[model samples]
Target: MTTRTPLTRARLATVGAELADEVGFEHVTASEVARRCGVRVASLYSHVRDADDLRALVCLLALDELADRASAAVAGRAGAEALAALAGAYRDYARAHPGRYAAMRHRLDPATAAASAGPRHADLTRAALRGYGLDADGETHAVRLFGGLVHGFVTLELAGAFDHSDPSPEVSWEWSLTALDATLTGWSTR
Candidate 1:
């Protein structure tokens, strides 16, 4: 007889994340995850409250993972180099794990969002923007702007929105970074 492996919240989440990558974030239900783990849906309830909880766990996991990548990408770098590193991290991660990328965008309660690595992502962005000489308000704005720009580009690229166009996504991405760098460097004067 085969012994069943013990299930835990973390393991369930890992499986859910993998499933998300395989199927899609929207389809990652507790039943599906349990099936993949060779267990029943009830088995997951002890570890997770419900499907929403499972998804939330996956979202938190994705946030932590992405933040780690972004942090490492920006380490010992500054200015345009830092910007490119940070953006590249997001783009690459999304390309590698589109489902996890979608999970990272999942809505979280305020407390959960505060406790997750979501803030680390913002902090990394703030640090990356420091060399641009932006004031507090400027830095805040830059963080939002940069996040939107990178996420937008990645989302579009993943959806094949750029596939039919000339000037490949890479070329457009590089151009966007250049423009962003120039704008940030001259932010104070503007």
Candidate 2:
């Protein structure tokens, strides 16, 4: 007889994330995860409260992973270099793990959100903007602007919005970063 590996929330979440990658995040159901795990759907309830709980676990996993990548990408770097690295981390992760990227946007309960890597992502953004020499309010504004630009661009790019566009998405990405750098450089003076 084969001994079965113990099932845990982490393992289930990992499987869910993989499923999301294959079938899209919206299609990651607890039944599907159980099927992949070779277990009954009812068994998974011992570890996760329900399908929503499983999705939330996957969301937490994605947030933690994204923050880790961003932290590493920005380490020992500042200004435009740090900005580019941070942005690149997001774009690359979204491109490579579209499902996990979608999971990262999942809404969590207040306590869960506060405990997740969501705050670390915020802190990393604020830290990365430190070299821009912005005041407190400026820092807050800059973080919002940076997130909006990168998220909007990546979302559109992933949807193939720039696939047939002229000048290439590569060219536009570089230009956008350059413009962002220039804007941040003059932010204090403005």
TM-score of each: 0.97, 0.95
Model 2, runs deviating above 4 Å: 188-190
Tens-digit lDDT string for candidate 1 (61-167)? 99989999999999999999999999999999999999999999889889999999999999999999999888888899999999999999999999999989798
How would you encode candidate 2's per-residue C-alpha lDDT over 23-64 as one tens digit per residue? 889999998999999999999999999889999989998898
Q: What is the lDDT of residue 183 in candidate 2?
A: 95
Model 1: worst 10 consecutive residues (lDDT sum): 181-190
lDDT of each: 0.92, 0.92
